[model samples]
Target: MGELVSTPLPTQFGDFLIKTFSSGNEDIPHVALVHPEVDFSKPVLVRIHSECLTGDVFGSRKCDCGDQLHLALNQCGAEKGVLIYLRQEGRGIGLTNKLKAYQLQEQGMDTIEANVALGFDADMRTFVPAVAILQSLGVDKIKLLTNNPIKLEALKEAGFLTVERVPLIGEEFDSNRNYLNTKREKMGHQI
Candidate 1:
């Protein structure tokens, strides 16, 4: 059995709360739930989102992170699932570096290239904590909502059965076109 670490986070959304669990590593914080009640065994709908402050908080048009998060919240609230907000900003590079990457993007670098230029891997995030969090909550299966195939593969490999892939489809505009395209072409995301 994996060790479980958790804490409550208050929010304005309906019954909103955050529960975090350690995935045998201090750096990675696995999670379960952002709104409503959390139930691990209920075949939840999970959204494994990487951190994005500009997009998620300010509704920045540079990426679909915020929109996707909003969609997930609505879906999870209605369907009773979990939204695991991983703190892996910029795919694990953190907010400061993500901003730097954004600047590089302004100079014509794609998201992946900008991360590489900043001395970071293209995608440094790991799914171990997510798996650990689900297991700790007794969730052995889920209906994951995402466009990233890798997330499904990782969760499955880590022993969480992805019974469904609920696509977080939405419109992308000029400001985020390149970012979305890069995610599709380079990252193999199903955007």
Candidate 2:
């Protein structure tokens, strides 16, 4: 595991601090958001969100990435939890290839098919560093908020005590319906 190198930044949200950490592995940058008044000794709410530049940054309608992010931030802020933003664009295929995959999706290909066509796995993200971040913060357990079962399994394998799975249910739209379905069916996510 890499060293926990993080620097805090200010946020408008109540007593929130954001930190960007280097992955030390040339994959994606890892980030951690610490909320005010969180008890490090107790289980915290954690959201392991993979990078979705188009939706997260530009508000693209192809998926619910941005909405999920915003919702995670709000929920975490309210409950004094943590949000670990992993920089695994397009499920760890990186940005350039992700854009190419987007073009393929526009041509009627689902997210999984687009990645497979591009010679990548359906979901290429890893969770080792997420556990590292949690450990660095002295967190031993969590109430995770996510629809991806892979995340829950990964955290369990990493030795974190995941006491509960808090479903992050959001409104579905026509644009993101197929994407969500692919995640539920192919990726085994509990959407």
Task: Point to the candidate with the largest TM-score.
Answer: 2
For each of the candidates, give the backbone clash count. Answer: 0, 0
What's the lDDT for all of these models?
Answer: 0.79, 0.84
Local error of candidate 2 at residue 72 (angstroms)? 0.6
lDDT of 1 by residue, 123-177 (tens): 9998776776667667788999989999999888887778988899767999899
> What shift in Å separates residue 171 of candidate 1 from its native position after superposition?
3.1
Task: Please provide TM-scores, in order, for all candidate models, with all chains considered together.
Answer: 0.86, 0.91
Off by over 4 Å in 2: 1-8, 25-28
Sliding window of 10 residues with minimal summed lDDT for model 2: 1-10
